[model samples]
Target chain A: MPALVVQWIVALVMLVGAFFILLASIGLLRMPDLFLRMSATSKAGTLGAGLLLVGTIVHFWDFSITTRTVATIIFLLLTSPVAAHLIARAAYFDGVPLWEGTRRDDLRGHYHTSTHTLDSVVRPAPDTEIPEMEGDDFPEEG
Target chain B: MMLDVLWSAILVMLSAAFVLAFIRLVRGPRLPDRVIALDLLTIVVMGFIIVYAVRSGQAAFLDVAIILALISFVGTAAFAYYIERRV
Candidate 1:
């Protein structure tokens, strides 16, 4: 393809991608309900980031980068939903409460409430040490 | 070349969808709402990437889209797990 034509095409791609990102941010800011908002944010953010990076790959047009980009996109699709699900579930458990007009909470009366205290809400247990980062702090190694 | 033009049109449409989704994200009332909106943004990003790949005729560009999708998913899952944890 002519260099000029390629440049124009890539530029347009970038332009559209950026607009999508802005929209995603807009959704993050405007949604009214917790669950609905998360749904919008998760999908839009993932898609927007994916689009931006893809534009980068196109602008470069190299095979190695292409492979890497493809892998990343797949990864995004795989993980985005799982994380979204976890967050939604957690928010519900933490008693964030559904929107005022919610007609139903499917989980209501369906699951048993847990008795375990959630001390790990903000930080992990101090005794649960991380691997390797323990470094010379490990007396045996020292 | 024909596909390129067609895809550009598609991209424009997707961009509009993105705007609608964003309005919802902003109006949300809680942290989860924000998080979810962020996640949705990630998806819209993926679509944008695809359009780039198609428009530039750089099929390889799809690779970045794949990776972004994966990394963001991990971020969301970790956050969710943390919030859901009982102890």
Candidate 2:
């Protein structure tokens, strides 16, 4: 490929990556609740970072840089979901209130706060009617 | 010249992102919100580092990006653990 074409590709990739990162931050600021913000930031942030790294690889076109970029992207892909999960689980147990518009909570009655264990038996089967659990069990804030 | 302009534009966008994430960090009502903001901040900074590496033609800075990624994950996990135990 021509040098000019390659430069354009690099620029385009970097621009998109920066755009995603900006979107993620905006979501983080504008989302209504903690879980919603986590969802927005984790996914968008990881993709943005990965794309930025890929742009670096293309710009350099060096074997060592490519290896490092691949490694970094892989590490990011592997760790981001885990980190999001950990933080979400902690937030849930910490009793972070769900948004008022949240329609259903699958873990509502199944989680045992005392033992930090979930009772699988309490999970509603797809075909069965879900028992209406009391919302008063936990505090809800708008 | 075109690449230079694009690079500077990207840098500006990433800086704006950093500031937005920082606002969340400061305005977050709860600990987890703050933690998530910090995590996003770190990721945005990583993007900045990658852009800098490309613009400066310094492959060495890529290593710093990698290290930042690792450290941010560790910090997030530690904060999660603390939150879980505290409550």
Candidate 3:
């Protein structure tokens, strides 16, 4: 009876995980922009993978396998958000256009292309003039 | 008996998901779109590896899944860096 119950639980967990993964892939296909796709895939993909790892732990009921499964889950959870953020920030700076339906973009006009800096507030114009350095501050030319 | 059927169904669903993600990878109009598709593909492949490990009763394969996850994260980060640094 216990074995039967375990089987059912594992099956249910795997089914749900697989469904979530499939939903993420579908979202990746259907989303209108890179950011939207990242939003869909990163969250759903991590959850799905984590759930599947949990199912593996339950199915095996072994100590080493459980440890590895937990490690994989933790790593996925830790890295997925960072990876998504990096990709999205890069994509935005690389000029990947947003969807037409996107109503607001707070980062627009605040990002300095040359310096790769972001200002908290949009400046009237990017300061192109280099402030004159004092004699002591300026390095001597070779 | 039922467990066999369920596993097979899950595998099929994952394969379909992989196909859909691959379609996006192929049809991408921009590099980021392709990168996102590749990331999704790695995720789907990870799920596939985990499911196979469960089905085959080979705990060894779980290691492969873990390594794959690590590699995918590294690959995504590298691609992001490349995109950011592009002239």
Candidate 4:
């Protein structure tokens, strides 16, 4: 590719990635509670870093750089969600407060308060009855 | 020319994010909040290091980025474990 084209692509990708990072930070600041902030940072921060890595690959375009960047990307994708999960679990066990409007927490009834472990017997109740057929009351007109 | 412009623009934005993350780090109501803020700050710093590597045309700095990312995740997970289990 031409130098100008590569530079333009890099600029655009970096711009978008940087914007996501900025948004993550803003969300971190504005969110009401720890869970929401975790959501923002985990998703947006990982995406932004991925985008920036893409930009780096485009700009550098070397054998070693490509390998390292791909490794970094994989590492990021694998770990971020797990990290978020662990943190959220810890927060829940620590009784970190949820946002006011937050309604249904399925885990509330499932987790053992003393042991901090989710119990298997406490599953969510399934929908018992399907809605009655709306238009099936009438027999075939034949 | 375009790369230069993009670099400055992104640098400015990331710096702003860094400052906001710092505020969260400092003004936390709980330990978990502080941990989250530290995680965010580490991510932003990783971004900064990656950007610097790109700007300077250095592949070595990417190693730093990789190490930083891995270490930050481990740190976050360890903190989570600490919060969950005291020992």
Best by DockQ: 2
Clashing pairs in 4: none
Report the C-alpha lDDT of model 3 over A1-142, residue by residue, as the tens digit: 2388898898889889999999999999999988998899999888888889999999999898899899989999999999999999898878787776665666766877776789888763554332233344334669
Model 2: interface root-mean-square deviation in Å: 0.7
Cα lDDT computed for each candidate against the true fold: 0.61, 0.89, 0.86, 0.85
Number of clashes in every candidate structure?
Answer: 72, 0, 0, 0
Q: Residue by residue across B1-87, what tens digits does model 2's lDDT show?
A: 877788788888899999999999999999999999999999998998888788778889999999999999999999999999998
lDDT of 1 by residue, A20-50 (tens): 5656556555555677666655666566656
Error of 1 at A95 (Å): 1.7
Q: What are the per-model DockQ values?
A: 0.27, 0.85, 0.73, 0.66
Scored by TM against the true chain B, the candidates give: 0.78, 0.94, 0.93, 0.91
| lDDT (Cα, 0-100) at A25 in candidate 1 | 55
Candidate 3's C-alpha runs over 4 A off are A124-142
What pairs collide in candidate 2?
A: none
Residue A31 miss distance in model 1 (angstroms) = 0.9
Question: How do the residues A1-142 of candidate 2 rate in per-residue lDDT, one tens digit apiece?
Answer: 3388888999899899999999999999999989999989999999999989988889889898899899999999999999999999999888888887676787865766666787876754354333454455456889
- Mind giving the per-residue lDDT tens digits that candidate 3 earns over B1-23? 98788988899889989999999
Cα RMSD of predicted structure 4: 7.9
Q: TM-score for every candidate vs. truth?
A: 0.58, 0.89, 0.90, 0.87
Off by over 4 Å in 2: A122-142
Task: List the candidate numbers ranked by TM-score, top first.
Answer: 3, 2, 4, 1
CA deviation > 4 Å runs, candidate 4: A120-142
